[model samples]
Target: MSENRLREDLCFWAKSLFDRGLTGGASGNISVRTEDGGLLVTPTGVSMGRLDPARLSRFDAGGRLISGDPPTKEMPLHAAFYETRQSAGAVVHLHSTHSVALSILPDTDPDNAIPPLTAYAVMRVGKVALLPFYVPGDAAMAEAIRGLAGRRASVLLANHGPVVAAKDLEAAVFAMEELEETAKLALILRGTGARPLEAGQIAQVVRKFEVDWD
Candidate 1:
């Protein structure tokens, strides 16, 4: 996509997420890789609901800020994914309620936070790693993500929220939404012995969808 269109789509999806309460009050950040190997990122201290396309941060492949406003402090977080995952075209991080709540639960699996409650989650998000909590905007959070070795498309930051990487901005947003919704489902089914997809069923979905189920 053209740089102009990428900027517009970034704002469009950011606003949609904010409007639906997926993120609020400057609690989310998004970045997409450009054709020239640069990145278009949301500006720091800006609410997702109010992002201006022309004002988005632009960074070259070497990580220097080239133009527009300063990028979010969570640049390290976005950087980790792009650096580690060759397939990543976009990265999204959000402080959504349900995913954050799920991250806080004592029994939430660190290796796979979101269960196979829905096939879409399984296909889009694959395994959702749960990382230990770190202070907001800390570089340690990015290090934790780096530890995943690019194996996971989605991760739940303990006490924070979800971060997702995908092939494009739209796919990242859609995968993030699926992850949050599955987290909501997991929370709702907590302690009810809710039957998740059987191992065989999960395998079928993984195989049929060619999911990155590592």
Candidate 2:
């Protein structure tokens, strides 16, 4: 798609996320790869609900800022995904409530933070790594993700929220939503003896959907 269209789409979806309460109060960032191998990122401290397409931060393939406002402090996190995941066309990070709550819970799996509570979660988010918390906007968060070596596309930052990378902007947003919802499910079912998809069922979904569950 054209750069203009991508900008519009980015703003549209960012607003959708904010309006739906998936993110709030400038607590999320979105970035998409441009056709020229650059990036158009949401501006620093801008509410996703109120993004202006023309004001999005633009960066060259070499990672130099080309125009628009300064990028978010979380740029390192986004950059790590693009450098590590060859298929990543977009990256989204959100301070959604449920996912953050899940991250704080004791004994949450670091390898797969959210269980296979639903097929959509399995198909969209795969295994979500739960990383230890870092101070918000800390470069160390990026280093932790880089340590994953791109083996996972979704991660929950402990005491913070979730980040997801996908083939494009829309896929990234959808996967992030799936992660949030699955986290909600997990939280709601805690100590309720809720039965998650069994090992075989999860395997079948992963195999059928070709999920990047590693």
Q: Tell me how far the alpha carbon of residue 91 in candidate 2 is from the true structure, in angstroms, after superposition.
A: 0.7
Tens digits of per-residue lDDT, candidate 2, 106-201, equal 999999999999999999999999999899889999999999999999999999889999999999999999999899999989999999998899
Output the lDDT of residue 151, model 1: 92
lDDT of 1 at 11: 98
lDDT value for candidate 2? 0.94
lDDT of 1 by residue, 63-148 (tens): 89999999999999999999889899999999999999999999989888999887888999999999998998899988988888
The models' CA-based lDDT, in order, is: 0.93, 0.94
**Model 2, C-alpha of 159: deviation from truth (Å):** 0.9
Off by over 4 Å in 1: none
Report model 1's TM-score to 2 decimal places.
Answer: 0.98
